[model samples]
Every structure is written in C-alpha cells, then in structure tokens.
Target: MGLVTIAGMAESGDIPMREPLAYFLTWTTYGTWLPGDQRGWVEKPGRFREPNRNMEVANREQMTEPEFVLTSPQRALVELTIRDHCKFRQWSMHAVNCRTNHVHVVVTATGYSPDDVMKQFKSWCTRRLKEHASKPEAPARGPTKNPANSLPLTLRQKFWTRGGSKRIIFDQEGMENAITYTLDGQ
Candidate 1:
C-alpha cells in the first residue's frame, strides 16, 4: 500500500569493483556490533548512547581526497538487477543506486509485502546470476558449503538476513531526502 525502500550489501562486505560477485540479499539492519539489549530499531544505537559512550566525526574536507568512485560496471549491474526484479514483480521504482558496498531502492509494490518482494527478487536474481556465471567445481575435500551458508541452518531458514527497517514516506520532503541519501552517501 505504501512505497518501500530496501538496501543490500555484498557478501561479508568483500565485493570488489572489477569482478562480478554472486548475488547476496540483505534487508536493513542496525549495526549488529551493538550491545545485546540494543539489537533492533527500538534501541536506535546510532542516535542513542550509553553512560560512557563517546562520538567522533572527522573533518574529511581537509583530509586526503577519496580515492575511488564506485565503478560503472558495479553500478550498472546493481541498477539492472533492481530494475529487472522490480519489473518482474510489477513494482515501481522511485529512486535507486548500487553503491560500492550497498544498494538502495525505493519502489511501490501493488500486492506484496516488502519481505515477500525481497525473497522473490533474491531468488530470481541469484538463479539468473548463477546461470551466467563460470564458477569452479566443488572441492574434493570434506564438508562442502550447503550452497548458501555452510554452518548448520534450520531447514526452513530464508535467504535474507532479517526484516528490513521502513519509514512512512508521507510527502515530497521525505521523498527528496530518500532520493538524495540513496544517490549520495550518508
């Protein structure tokens, strides 16, 4: 019923700009490194602080210039992936970008939850990617990866890491901020 914005990152954050890496799906998450009681949105760790917490913001304008721009190939693959999946699912894209470490997409789905949309998108995209890829055969050693995660997983486990965080986009101002944040950095 409302617009959705989703973001995903490369596997273990190890994607390089030059190579086409396998598709891995992720939903929004607050930093998992926070304290146990601060795990989800109810805690909002980015804005919250403990008794002895300290914050830091370095001045980058006077520091060394940024060395890399997110590459064209990497950006294009992400863009195409989002577009293809959205089109396949009848979603409308308001804005999106495939940045170096993550991807952001804003869309409206007619008849689906954002979680359902993400699952289908990940399945189709991962299958298509494997179809077009050239990967080495499984190693002739013990205990191969289970084709997803190697660790023992629940049989009914899903692909995405967790439920995505969402905000209600009520007007033009929210839309503008969403677009700007997706295109540029935080």
Candidate 2:
C-alpha cells in the first residue's frame, strides 16, 4: 500500500457542494449596476437585449440614497478585513482588491463552498464597516436619517447585491490566470 500527500487537495468531507480546487470570487454592492448599463446587464435566468428600464427604476427606488460607492478609506477597510479573515481561516489568498463598486478575491479554501466563503467575507466586512463608521470621530459623508445617530448613513444602506460571480480554478494554469486577473485585470 502507498500513501500520497497532495498540495492544495481538499478532503471529500470538507466540501458539501461541488468541490473546486480553488475559487475566484467577485461581488458588487447594491444599486451599482442598473438594468440598462452600457456594459450590459444580467437579471434572472435569461439575458435581455435592451436594458430593463422597469428593473432599473425599481432598483433605484428601493435604495435609500443614490448608488453605493466605497470611499478610499472604506475600500481599505474592506480589503484589510478580507485579508485578516483569510489569514484566520488558514486559507491561501492569492489576490484581492476592493474598488468603489465591487470587490474581487482569489483564494484556495478546501472543504468550504464558494458561497460560504463569500458570505463570510461579506458579513465580516459589513460588521467591521459598521463598527468603523459608528465611531464618534468618523467623518460624515452621506445623508442621514438623524443627525444625532451614531452610524454613518452609508453603513445603514445595503453594502452588496444578492449573488456574484464565483469561478473555479481547477489547475495550476487556471490558478495562475485567475491570480493575474485579480491582481492586474481589476
């Protein structure tokens, strides 16, 4: 009998859903992409030719304010939070970048679903953001429900959309390509 050890290999029990060698995940904040975006848009199962005006209007109406944009400091906070979370989980983080509208991260975490990882990152980041914005010295940027309130107006708003792109990297080449895209393409 022979025993073998494989690098970056996940045990069978670790992954409940489809087991990917690694994951390249990306998600955007709510109201960032409207129905008739010049870059095109996706809603539901099928794709539409023209932007869904009704959908765009509904999305905007649901927002408490205008589109959600992350400030430089806020982006930094999110990126740091993600790095810290990955470190604590002992996951191999290839690359990560947080922009005003969206965030991208490439990581290898066996025994965990991509959705689980995304949720963890989003939840932790949101909590940290709320905490940071609630501080007494934090600068005020957006419209507030109550001027006396402790939390920032943006913090009270939705930070991310429902679902996002989660791609699986199955091989060394795929991992390298994903990492390059995350670090440079973003």
Question: For every model shown, what is its TM-score relative to the native structure?
Answer: 0.46, 0.77
Q: Give the runs in model 2 whose Cα sits over 4 Å from its true position.
A: 1-19, 44-50, 140-157
Give lDDT per model, in order. Answer: 0.41, 0.71
Candidate 1 global lDDT: 0.41
lDDT of 2 at 126: 86
1-186 in candidate 2: lDDT tens per residue? Answer: 111113332222243243476877888876688666656675532334467667667767876645666777888999999999999999988899898899989888988878899999999988888777777776544444433332454457577888776666656776777777778986
Candidate 1 ranges beyond 4 A from true positions: 1-75, 135-160
Worst 10 contiguous positions by lDDT, candidate 2: 1-10
Worst 10 residues of 1 by lDDT: 54-63
Top of the candidates by lDDT: 2
